[model samples]
Target: MRHVIGREEADFVFIQETKSKELSDARCFVIWGDNNVGWIHNKGDEGSGSLLSMWPKDVFEYESHVMGTGYIAVYGQHLKTSYRCVVVNVYSSCSLRGKKTLWEDISKVRQSSHVLAWCICGDFNAVRSSNERKGITDRGEQKSEVNGFNSFIDSNFLLDLPLVGKKFTWFKPDGTAKSRIDRVLVTEDWLLLWPKSKQYVLRREVSDHCALVVKSVEKDWGPKPCRTIDAWLLERGFNRMVKDK
Candidate 1:
């Protein structure tokens, strides 16, 4: 995560796998920037779920929404994604049957009244394209799964940003190549607002799946030229003219 931050020169970062509630000290380990905000799930006895944490406190207006078992939404704001936006940190269920319920839950969030932009990202655990997979043994199930995910995105009009460096984010530790599962999906409003937004796959240090970082292209404010006038002459003439008038 720190590697990408330094390389990409990002101001605000959203991390999904902190795996802890106390992020006050962890933020320092991730990057040099100050003002961090952490939102973590309540780790119950089950010991299965994910969380969202971020830095540069000014970026996000912190809020929480509990969708279901492991799914949660940690709301944040930024110029990217939409003119008015809320970023969702999602950790979806691994089981295909469970994904059906997860999709419905996500759709409900989309249909909600004030949702201007919905940016969902995390380890989705489902592949969208046949080209995304490797050494495919079971095409039927895989095709069905991809179709389901595509239907979800199409029905919602979510835009999947083009991945930068690495093509595959997750791989079997046993030296088996597999599908690209981890992804970042944005809405039309987000793409329209920041067309240059992108996702990059980072090297895996902790888990089999690599981490993803999404960046919105910042609008450049062109260079400004300094202007100067004779301060003494301007003051004398301006005061005299004003007095006479």
Candidate 2:
């Protein structure tokens, strides 16, 4: 996964279901390029613990905690996740308590006014709307989960970028349909700072889920030609040679 992503020249990358046992050395080598990289891994067999990792040899002023799966709050500049924004990587559990844990973590971050721009990316493990599902019929319990997810986003004023092409990120190899489980959520302030922000689904090779690429408009220069001809190329001799040919 890291090798493939490295080729894409992505600034930041978030991965879930890494299935690593050790927290210290859980990240793939290729993901850690010449820039900074942050990660939070699930701890324990029951998946109740979390791990955070980063690179680039810069000390980051951060506040992080282990909820259910993992959540890492990073404060740094020119990092893999951002050039001038704070990046939070999270992996929430799929239980009732997990929802509460996620909410608590988010609330803590909101209380901290130090964070200006933020982008939270990971496997939420919960569907937001019925339109996000594929085959599973909305049951009472599922509806409740969806409602909780929507409420969380609404209260936080987060925006889920409109997905293009494939709606569902994960699917059963047996041909059964499923919901769009994985996503990248950004705060209103972050969107305002980067109005051209967008997320793209990368091809899934090793894992069952596809990877997401989130980009900001900080470096956009519109569309431009790749090459240009100098005045010498349009000289009389060059025109005469072309005419002779």
Candidate 3:
């Protein structure tokens, strides 16, 4: 967990399925590596699910937050970019009926906060297509669920950002089932704010689901640009071009 965060240099992080009713600042500090983070948490109910959304105070100005049954929406200003936006961290229900309510809840928030750009991200617990799931036990109810999830995205005008690291965000321990249920969906306004934004599916070390990091591609995550002398100045063609100019 720490490795992934460090590697990404994440400004914000959203985690679901915390399964803890109470979280201490000390614990959070350990996970976040400092006290400079501000966070909103929704404790897990019994064995259901929990949510935690964290952002560096230096990078994001904390405003207000809204929390529902399965999600937490944090509204703030991204200091680096000076853009105000809302980030919704979600952990959905396994059943379709429960999931519908979750979707509606988020949609209501979106409608209410229509002016603010939105980044809706987390484990959706649903998929948009058959291709996204494999080796599933429940095929009978899959198609309807797919349609419902898709409809939610379409109705809310959210764009599903392309994933970079992995095709599937989850895999059964025995390698039986695989699905791309976790994702980052953003409003068009949000896309305009961070045009190079994409979600990276990173290593799944301790959890069954892979850690997701959504960031703008400032540059390709590769080796630093190599320093070079002005070798082109030595070329005869370059001298000719300079002379012609």
**Number of clashing residue pairs in every model?**
1, 1, 0
Give the per-residue lDDT of model 1 (tens digit) for 125-177.
78888888786577467777888999998988888988997888877787577
Please give the range of 10 consecutive residues that has the lowest summed lDDT in model 1: 1-10
Give the number of colliding residue pairs in candidate 1: 1
Off by over 4 Å in 1: 1-35, 42-45, 79-83, 218-245
Task: State which candidate, 1 or 3, has the greater TM-score.
Answer: 3
Best-performing candidate as measured by TM-score: 3
RMSD (Å) of each candidate, 1 decimal? 10.9, 7.6, 5.0
Candidate 2, TM-score vs. the true structure?
0.70
lDDT values for all models: 0.64, 0.62, 0.83
Q: Which regions of candidate 2 deviate over 4 angstroms?
A: 1-8, 23-68, 79-84, 217-245
lDDT of 2 by residue, 1-245 (tens): 22111112554455454555665432344546433544545453543434333433343333453334356555555434444556666666777667767866776676664666677776677888778778766566777788788888887777897665677877767747766777878887777766777776777777677777766545658998667478858787986776798
Q: Lowest lDDT 10-mer window, candidate 2?
A: 1-10
Candidate achieving the largest lDDT: 3
